[model samples]
Target: MLAKIEELLEQAKLAIDSATSVEVLYEAKVKFLGKQGSFSHLLKEMGKLTPDDRKTIGKRANEVRDILEGKYAVRENLLKDQELNSQLEAQKIDVTLPGVAPERGVLHPLWRVTKEMCEIFSRLGFSVRTGPHIEKDFYNFDALNIPPDHASRDLQDTFYINDGVDRKPGDFSPWLLRTHTSPVQIRSMLTEKPPLRIVSPGGVYRSDSDMSHAPHFHQVEGLLIDQDVSMADLKGTLGFFAREFFGSEVEVRLRPSYFPFVEPGAELDASCPFCKSKGCGMCKGSGWIELGGCGMVHPLVFKQVEMEYPKWNGFAFGMGVDRMAVVKYGVSHIGLLTENDLRFLGQFRP
Candidate 1:
């Protein structure tokens, strides 16, 4: 029985050494040490031997089992270390690779041009002022010297929220999206006493859309109210703006035009920056670009705001911010400004 136990220990040692994994090593342990195993079978046969011989065989079997268990524990730890090293090698990352850069965002072209225009005016003692997009009929039209019967007040031109109907007389002014930033001028005048120098810039809505126009657009309106303001001051102010904005050499000209709120309203034009006023496709061979409208504030406009006309007269001018952006950046379409396509907007990045 002792000889048989020595042989079993040798076989268990060989099995444990050849095991590639902990699972295989465990099966080898069970083969020798388990109830139906060689070692257990040999112990059961010890009853046939003398009592002294049985005691000697049991002691030898216990020593063999302890030796085999130690061998298995050492082999199991070695296999586990190898497995962990292989897993870590598979997951290792290279530290020297260049990192991916994140994308950056920029302002829309319309807003860029709006800021530029406001900054130019801001440098000239004109403080910025803003008003609500939703406006009352009195401030938008009546206070701006635009009569109810005016063509601009028609449903075809303006967008009305309440349509000024079905209300008790003098209940409240009907609401509508403002047609121009001129309403902001009226708002500022009604609230504050002048000498006021302000430039109003904001979104305006109208029932209009085309290659050059949009249903929703932006405008910057300028107002200067004080004693003895004149058309010359308006022209000089606009002229300086044209030279500074377009180029140092660009010239300005105002063609005689009519508007409801100005005594001598004129269409403001600047020499084409592209052609240097030498005639081109951009200016349609005229060498001039129509910018916007400017004129002296009308007497009735002052009356509506309850300011004395000749005593507190001023000049007001308005220009389309979208149009300015189109002209400055040479954008093909006004509608491109409204479309949120990153491809189109990416070109205007500063």
Candidate 2:
């Protein structure tokens, strides 16, 4: 039995030394030390021996087990260290390699143009103002001198909230998405006194969409009120804006037009920057490009806001911000500004 135990220990030692991995070493340990193993089988046979012989064999067996356990532990740790080193060598990163760069984002062209226009106006002594996209009928129309029967009040032109279906016969004015930023001017006039110069830039909604128009668009409207404000001041300011925004060489002109909120309104035009006022396809063979509308404030508008008419005269001008972006960036369609295509928008990176 002693010779057999010694032979088994030698076999275990050889198995432990030959094992290439921890899994193989664990299998070797189970083979010798398990319940059905050689060591357990030898102990079972000792039941037939005398008590003194059984005690001596048990002592020898325990010493052998301890020695084998120590050997297995040392071999296991060495194998683990070698495996870790191999993995480290295989997975090491190259310090000389260039790091991957993350993609960057840019401002949308619409917002970029909006900020540029606002900054340009800010330099001209106009502070910025904004109003709610959802507005009351009074501020949008009535206070702006736009009569109830005006063409813009029709369902086809304006987007009325709740479709005006929940209104009673004599309730408050109907709510609607604002048609223009002019409502901001009205609200400003109600709370502020004359000598107010402001530019309102924000989104407006209409019940229309086409190549040139959209259901939702943006506008920048300017209002300047003081004693003795006139059409000449409006033209001069607009001309300076054209020169500064388009180019130092660009010129501005005003043609007779009509708007409800102004006593004398004119369509604002700029000499085609693309052709330097020479005929071109951009200006449709004409030397001018229609920019927007400008006018002297109507007396009826002042009456609605309770401001003395002639004592506090002013001029208001409004232009489509989308149109400005289109002209500035040479975009083919107004609808392109709203379409969230990355391919189209990626071109405007700063």
Index of the highest-lDDT prediction = 2
Off by over 4 Å in 1: 1-64, 86-95, 163-173, 278-281
| Clashing pairs counted in every model | 0, 0
TM-score for every candidate vs. truth? Answer: 0.83, 0.84
- Shift in Å, residue 60, candidate 1: 5.1
lDDT (0 to 1) per candidate: 0.88, 0.89
Q: Which stretches of candidate 2 lie over 4 Å from their true place?
A: 1-10, 42-67, 83-97, 100-103, 163-173, 278-281
Clashing pairs in 1: none
| Candidate 1 residue lDDT tens string, 174-211 | 68899999988998999999999999999999998776
- Model 2 lDDT tens row, 1-350: 88888998899889989999999999998999878877888888988989898788789999999989999999999999999999999999999999998877889988898888888888889999999999999999999888788889988889877754666753334799999999999999999987999999999999987767789988999999999988999999999888888999999999999999997999999999999878887788899988899999999999999998789999999999988888788888778888899899989887
Candidate 1: Cα lDDT at 129: 97
Candidate 1, run of 10 with poorest lDDT: 164-173
Alpha carbon lDDT at 306, candidate 1: 92
